[model samples]
Target: MSKNLSALSFRKGVEKNVFERMVDAADKAGTAEKNDIVHQMGQDHLFGDAITLGAVSFYDFLKKENEGKKVFLCNGSACLCAGTQDKLHHTLESHFKKEEIGHICCLGRCHEGGAFQYQGKNYSGQSDAAVADLVKTGKGDSEDRYAVVSHLQPAILTAEFPGIDAYYEPFKKLIANGDRDALGADLKDSGLRGRGGAGFPLHFKWASCRAASGPVKYIVCNADEGDPGAYIDKYLMEKQPHSVLLGMMVAGWYAGAETGILYIRAEYPDSITIVNEAIEDLRSAGLLGNDILGTGFNFMLKTIKGAGAYICGEETALLASIEGQRPEVRTRPPFPTIEGLFRKPTIVNNVETLANIRAILTLGGKGYAKIGTPQSTGPKLVSLDSWFVKPGIYEVAMGTPLQTIIDLAGGFKTKVKALQIGGPLGGIVPMSHVGKLTMDFESFKYGGFMKGHAGIVSIPESMPMIEYIQHLFQFTADESCGKCFPCRLGSTRGKELIAKARTDSGFKIDRELITDLLDTMEQTSLCALGGGVPLPIKNALQHFGEELKGYFAD
Candidate 1:
């Protein structure tokens, strides 16, 4: 009976594993309170009930209240900025019971203010007809609403997007040549940094995994893109899935690994379905399974849908989630490349980083390097929020002017005072500083900002700066993994402090107290979740002090 339950827990049409049973069980039962199934999973996996529950309880989607919900509203930064979530919620309530509606962080529909999930499909709630049709007949309208274009002369990421064929040509050529060393060399020459905000060199990680001695190695693509305004990864995975898969296959070949895992967010149901289809297509084309293309190279790719934890976007937490453990941040030095998934050498690259692999190979290292600046090479994909006149994904050279990007997006729809470049952890750039910045790692870093995920969320002139700060703290508090005190406690405390000040006009926020708090979190937090949250907060305090006056005590 236990074996049957365990077997049943594994999702169909994907490789089998023990860790995913808890997610599958919770998904099937619509609640994590299935004690019998939890016990079975614990017993089969050789773990305790507490560990199983911890794993199940880590995701926001598995909450008991969210169970069996037919609608989910987007409270992401884009939606928040547009002030459409409340109206969307009210509209959804008119159609279904209030209990039937839930909330999600982001749905990669930042271009459209009203983003929601209905019956496991993403839809923009911006249109009343679309929502009415969905509520009435289950099937809504289907049209290509978002724009995806490249400003470069020769596009890299979006070149083959909206079309998925012949992406394996570079991989086939690599197999024919059998020069694995050149793969590493080209990546190094291309100077491709991680697009996932850390800006780490891609070749260094690939080389580290290649050099590590392990009988079993793994290549993981971090498709858990939790950044609220960011959907570049989603665009690539949904439209050009072959590009993502081919990149993973290339990494597997170079790093001497046979297995690859793509961890996509549960919010992105379309990405999961499309990637799964693409993997099956690869197998059919004789490009995926053992002894591929008449060569001895063997690679198998599968997808793991995230249970909706933002911290899982972090590589170590992602690894933990895949291992069926609590998705807490693990201490490093034993970096992922050294000791990763299943205690083997693992190469975890961002979705955009992996998507760039095909481009690097096709253009050659030096040729690809010539597109962007000296330090920041290759073109990058940037996502613009709904405030823009034309909000969508645009691929631009790495060092393109920030103003140029805004202009390309058709500028703001209304008067905008500031821009929140990157995600929650990124700096809050006042409109005056827009001309001083460019779209590169060094440029943003030099300007006291982070080019993280390159998703720009506009702050309207009407919204108070204090309110924005409050949102950041609240986001961090809600998403903290609770492993360390600094993040778990600090984020909550920060949110409360901001709340108190906002509610009580006479309440003066002690600058010293907040400064000390930020310093402690920045210095002592276990991971970026705790540490990086201070950046945007500090940027606000520094850049928008006049706007935030009368709230501070010091």
Candidate 2:
């Protein structure tokens, strides 16, 4: 019999496969089965029970509260703005007990509200009849729906999805030529910035990883698309899986990495299934695995379904999660490109960023660079939320005017008060500024906003500014990884302040105190989750000050 483990033996890091095993154990466990599984995992991995439990606790889906839940309603910002979660909740409660119901942050079904997950499948349009049908027949009539549009003359990211035969051509040609230098040079010349929130130059990360000293390097595709209204990654993973895979393959080839991991979120069940299928298709086509296309170069790919921790979207935290550690943000300097994923050099790119790789290689760096602005090169995917008449994903040049994209989405369904572009962490844009702003990073930054993930969650005239602020704080408080006090405690405090102001009309928020709090959270927080939440709140205070007048004291 194995002795009770007292501490972690693997100082370097746990094996990468341990995370998937833990997730599998959690998924298969019942309410009473957790302790036994935890103990077993401890024995199997030689981790202390406390450490194992701590890692397991980071993911909300692995918690005991959700053990018996039959359905999960999306409490994402888009769904909240649509005002459908309550109705969906009530309908779900009629079938499953309140204890049997749970909530997930976002389902990437922001194009339609009333999104819910049932038995590892996602469904939207949660009408009463739909809920009833779901409960009775184990399936619902409402199918997932969204439009795909491209404004570019020759669509890049939004181009028609290709089959296996066509998918491997670019990669095969790349292998035959064996011009890794040209590949890197082309990426640099193309001026491609990461489509992920940071907008860092893609080539810099690739080059850094390539130059980093390590025996084993990793290419991690961040498919944890936790941004509430952003389904761009989801669309790419589902519709253009090959493009994403090809991108990773290119990165593997260029970076001299042999393995790639696609860290897809558990909320996106369909995306997980589709991407897994796509990986198998690639493996069969001689595009993946040992001796690829009969060349000496070998590349293998696998997927890890994130266990519902939004902070795992952060690269360091994501690396930790994959290593069977707590998904807390690690301080940078020894960045992921230097020491990541088992303390080896790792290139972590988001789904959209990886998806853009094939296009860049095919078009040549200069040619691809010509598609968008000089600063923000390449096509970007914008996710217009449910408020739009034509709510879906659109591919447009980076410098396209915000108003033009809005028009492409068929405008709002109702008179909008403001728009929350990017994710929850991005700045809130007032309706008046929409026409003045452009889609590029520089433009949005100039306008005191971020084009993060380019997801537009519209706040209608009906929703109170105070309520929206509360939502922001609540989201931050819940999603915070608790590694930094500024984010962990600050988010809770911010939420409480707003809640107090909302309930007690006589209770006025001290502006100085709030400002100091925001300043601290922004200045000292370890990662963007804490640092970035203040952007939207600060934007609200600056732009929607009048709407939030009574809540604050001068």
Candidate 2 per-residue C-alpha lDDT over 1-554 given as tens digits, one digit per residue, 9 for 90 to 100 = 11122113234233436678778876777331277777777677777567678888778888676688778889999999998888888877789888888899899889988898888888887678867877898876545789899999888888886677776778888987769888889999999898888899998999999999867888999999599999999899998898888899899888989989999999988888989998888767667778887877888888888888999999989988877777888878888899878777889999999988888778899989988899998899999989999999999998999999999988989989899999999989999998899899999999898889988899999999889999999999999999899999999999999999999979999999999999999999999999999999999999988889899998
Each candidate's root-mean-square deviation in Å?
3.3, 2.7
Clashing pairs in 1: none
Off by over 4 Å in 1: 1-14, 142-144, 161-165
Clashes of each: 0, 0
- By TM-score, who's the top model here? 2
Whole-model alpha-carbon lDDT for candidate 1 = 0.85
lDDT tens readout by residue for model 1, 419-454: 888899888898999999999999999999888999
State residue 337's C-alpha deviation in candidate 1, in Å.
1.0
lDDT (C-alpha) at residue 372 in model 1 = 82
